[model samples]
Target: MGGNHTQIDFILLGITDSPCLQTPLFVLFLLIYIVTQVGNVGIIILVRVSPSLHTPMYFFLTHFAFTDICYSTVISPRMLADLLSEDKTISFTGCMMQLLTFAFFAISECHLLAMMAYDRHIAICHPLLYVTIISSRVCWQLVASSYLFAFLTAITCTWCTFGGSFCGPNSTDHFCELFPVLKLVCSDTHSSEMLIFAFITFNAVGAIVVIFLSYMSIIHTVLRMCSAQRRARAFHTCASHLMAVSMYFGTGFFMYLQPPSSHRSLDKVASIFYAVLIPMLNPFIYSLRNRVVMGSLVKCGRRIFSCWQHRSFLSSRTRTVHLK
Candidate 1:
């Protein structure tokens, strides 16, 4: 206990002492970061203002936009900072905070994606009962619950994780993460890692199962539809959702479930996918593919332009009045 306490106090508080890699990495990440923020924020605004996209699927798509924004916010800023700095250092508390928030939104995204799958399921499976089954109230509930579940789960996971002592050698090889951080803990982390793994697995794999089943049910129901347009619309609605799910899960599951025995590059590659690429892709996958979103996007763009034009005209009138 004494040694443990001493080690904890001696802990290195910031990011890794590794030298910064600037120029290329910084500029690339900066551009991607800008694009990601713009795209996701754009999606959110478009959906929120568009009456045509106020339905359940678009409602969930709005959450997807939000998830992209949040997920990127959790990781990208620090990454961009580290790229510019000499040491890629993060404080112990800061790292944990990042891990917790990232995992929270990430897990929320897992469930959110599944909830969206369920939304598609209901839409395709029970078109007649879609409104009755997935009412506006229920949609809000799902959204709210995803947030609550994410918060609670992160608290639980962080509690379990931090309960174990990180006794020494806090040089996490890659970035802010649970498993990599856990490995640095000098205490007996076998049980802790196991527990963390179980929770992670449940969130990751369990979501995959639920999403798969929901899609299966949706497919079964959609096949029964006699109308071609009905089938086409159903397929289109679910296609975008499935694509988002696959991208998220494919990168995520590979990252977590891959044997630790695999190459060291594995974690970095996987982290890049979930930590960066996934956020950049999510809004595009969910919104740009949808016709309603495209129409709303155009309308929103025009509205913004008109507002700018109106402001310019008003400013000209004000100048004339002042001159007079």
Candidate 2:
């Protein structure tokens, strides 16, 4: 892979080498990236402006959407640039920074999803205490702790991975990722690999366990309800979250849990799904199926139209009076 170089200054990403495929891939991901940004931004705005959605659930969703926006921004723009550029190279520092930022946001998102599941559990299983249990102070603490933990994890992973010798092939099979980057290291990586595997497993399994326990409690409470409508509403409220969680964790687990050589192509596809497609899908997944969000969107649209009409009417009246 390397001729005589002992250390590398730049890493190349071999996403695809086909000349014919470059433009198509660029357009496709460009569109997806645009939709991802707009959709996530819309979710943030919708949650902010809708008083009916000022509940703890939407509060969690707003933060979730924000995280999606952030990580997507970090990864997609660079990938899109590489698709169009002849040399798909990243500086060592750039790659390290990307890894750090991507890991932090992604890990924070996992904790946030777990917290959301717990919020749903409390909301459905103990409705009366939902507000008291998920107060503003409590919500802030949960979010803050998640972020802090993720930051620390990212630092540890980044430090361990970059501390090794990296004299192998500078080209990565897919975009810059933990496993792909780790594979490029020429030094003994057993300790780094073990640390990464443990860290990822701990975070993923912990979040999954929290989600499982919360959902189990929710199901039991839901089963005890006498009213069909209440049960349906509860299930409906959770459906979006379950979908988002599944897509995020399922793809992430599949991508990271295995060795890179066993499924390089498959892992790349999975990475694209979670990094690009999932972010674009999240706002729709959460908002489209939700009656409250739809209602708020409709209401917001009508208010904007009414205000435009009023402004037009006032402008016309003023012009006529001045002319006469």
Candidate 3:
């Protein structure tokens, strides 16, 4: 046992002495994962089933919900596995893949959220011109851009993350990551890290800056409206998006923009924030705040109940007919 313990530590740092608190933490995270999955899936179902929600806004939102689910699933299962593992050393390849996939989702989401904000800005600030501006072709183009950007980011991150040479001791703390993994490499990783940092900052920060600009323009436009009622109405539409955009930018910036000081605890904290929590929260933020989404959910709920009741009635009628 002593020899095995020594080998494990030498191999990589693992949670040999995880406190009893870890059990509850695992349970809590499990519950959060379940709810996040169900909520996002439910939103997707409701949005698809309700014709009223078959518009550009809800369409983007459906994709958003889907992305949230993917985002959560990407990190949570591995996180749960880590809690039970004796050795936390992910394979070099696995680490690069995780970092790539995670970056893809994270970067895509930033752009998507910014695009949604721009959608709302066009809708509210230029009501008459909204249709002409964000037509079906344009909407699909925006969606295409999101996917293409994510694909490019994924390829770029994966290539650069693997660009650094790992001679031995391939152990990364907290989980699979680019920087964390790179830190353990025997080679000088400065150039690779710098390249990745530049790419991510440009993608994430640039999207956020674009969002800020659009919102500022929106604010200017809203201020020009003489009617308090119109301003209030516009505010109502904008608040949910603003809140979501803030959460994405705030948590995202915290994750990427910081200096590469490898703090294992902050890695876990930041990981949970942007990866797990935000995905779970997006469905709520998009649905609860949007009137159309709320309506669609209500309609989906009604249709579900009606189907159940109808089936019950039919079963009861069959019994009565057989008795007669």
Best by lDDT: 2
Please identify which of the two predictions, 1 or 3, would achieve the higher lDDT against the true structure. Answer: 1
Instruction: Please provide TM-scores, in order, for all candidate models, with all chains considered together.
Output: 0.88, 0.95, 0.90
lDDT, candidate 1, 258-291, per-residue tens: 5433536456767877778878887778667888
Model 2: which ten-residue window has the lowest total lDDT? Answer: 1-10
Model 1 segments more than 4 A misplaced: 1-21, 259-263, 307-324
- lDDT of each residue in 1-324, candidate 2, tens digit only: 222324465555656879799889989999999998999899999889989999888888899999999999889888888878877778788888988999999999999999999999999998898889999999999999999989988998887677777866787754567887877788777878889888888888999999999999999999999999989999999999999999999998898877655665677788888888998999999889999999999999999999999999999999999999
Instruction: State how far residue 171 of model 1 sits from its true place (Å).
Output: 1.2
For all predictions, the C-alpha RMSD in Å is 3.2, 2.6, 5.0
Candidate number that wins on lDDT, 1 or 2: 2
Compose the digit string of candidate 3's lDDT tens values, residues 70-106: 8788778777666666556565556666777777777
Note the Cα lDDT for every prediction shown: 0.76, 0.87, 0.75
Q: Please give the range of 10 consecutive residues that has the lowest summed lDDT in model 3.
A: 1-10
- Model 2 TM-score on a 0 to 1 scale: 0.95
- Give me the runs in candidate 2 sitting further than 4 Å from their true place: 1-7
- The model with the greatest TM-score is 2
